[model samples]
Target: MKNRMTLTFDSRSENESLARVTVSGFMAPLDPTMEEMMDVKTVVSEAVTNAIIHGYDSEDGKDIELHCAYENDELVIVISDNGSGIEDVEMAKEPLYTSKPELERSGMGFTIMENFMDHVLVTSSPGNGTRVELRKKMVAKDRVCH
Candidate 1:
């Protein structure tokens, strides 16, 4: 088991960049490799972007929550939104699949997250909101000296 951190922000596209910065700071002390840190940063961005674009429809006043916990040599991140939920989880995750293709979305959010994170899970239902959880194991063998 290791340290844990959580962050929450209102549904605002401008806030997504800040989320990435914060996640970087949270994982920095762990002395993660540049690639690992980038992976975490990208996953956080995709999750937040999905919540903003799909979950909240780029609207304001809603909220998104991000939680990070380290345990058993792995880091777990949970991104959740309180907005219109997904109608179909399986279909949503398919490669090049997106509910907002008209907006030019590549439907690669889930794919990128799945590829970068060791494990990814999505749960949502109409009017209930959606949650995307990702987990990645730390590869460093020695104690990280920060």
Candidate 2:
């Protein structure tokens, strides 16, 4: 079975949870383990946060796009933003590299997503936009009810 969903919302901090919850609910039918579900939610949160903070520079009224597709135990997620794109994707992926030092950003968003997901790909260009693609293979746990 294959399932897919696409969501576009304003780039706001409050909408971050909305994105996470929507993705989680969308994947519920696959019977993913708690750990796997959490991983998905965490990555979604990170991507949305990056879109708002770094991509759009916290500018209101911008739109952040999230697309998810699940098939054959594999889930693919893509988050994109039409805000200011990344100049150096390599440097941004490095751990502890924050463009905004004043905000005390840890700059571990990409690192966390890469660690949790099976694969992570980032495509961006200055003044263009950014698209983050994450993929994960899920194994459904056998539930034993008492």
Candidate 3:
């Protein structure tokens, strides 16, 4: 059986945790490991934070959208913002490359997503906003009790 969820919220920094928790709950049926859960939450945070900070410049009035779909062993998530889009996605994906350096940002958002998820796809235009799609396949857990 396939399951899906969508959440749209204000582009506020405080709402980042909300997005993370919502996704984690939605993924409960997957029986994901603690590490998998944390990775998913962290990626959600990164995407939502990017929308709030970089996309809207921390303006706090725009909207950030999150869509998730999953089945028995696969999950796919897409987070998008209709704020200022990326000018060069390739450059943005580089490790330690942050456009807003003065904010003390680490610029590891994309890198982290890439590391944790099985696949990451980014699409953006200068004025069309940005979308990040993350896909992962869950591995069966080993329930060995010693």
Clashes of each: 0, 0, 0
* Candidate 1, residue 83: how far the Cα is off, in Å: 0.6
Q: How many residue pairs clash in model 3? A: 0
By lDDT, highest first, what's the ranking? 2, 3, 1
Candidate 1 per-residue lDDT, tens place, 7-52, comes to 8899998889989998888776667788999999999999999999
Poorly placed runs, candidate 2 (over 4 Å): 143-146
Model 1: lDDT to the true structure? 0.89
Deviation of model 2 at 43, angstroms: 0.7
What TM-score does prediction 2 earn?
A: 0.95
Residues 1-146 of candidate 2: C-alpha lDDT, one tens digit per residue? 79999999999899999999999999887788899999999999999999999999999799999999999689999999998999999999999899998998998999999999999999999988899999999975675641
Measured over all alpha carbons after superposition, the RMSD of each candidate to the real structure, in angstroms, is 1.7, 2.4, 2.7
| Native-referenced Cα lDDT, model 3 | 0.93
CA lDDT, candidate 1, residue 68: 89
lDDT digits (tens) for residues 1-146 of candidate 3: 58998989999888999999999999988888999999999999999999889899999879899999998689999999998999999999999999999999999999999999999999999889999999999888764631
Instruction: List the global CA lDDT of all models.
Output: 0.89, 0.93, 0.93
Off by over 4 Å in 1: 142-146
* Cα-based lDDT at residue 41, candidate 2: 100
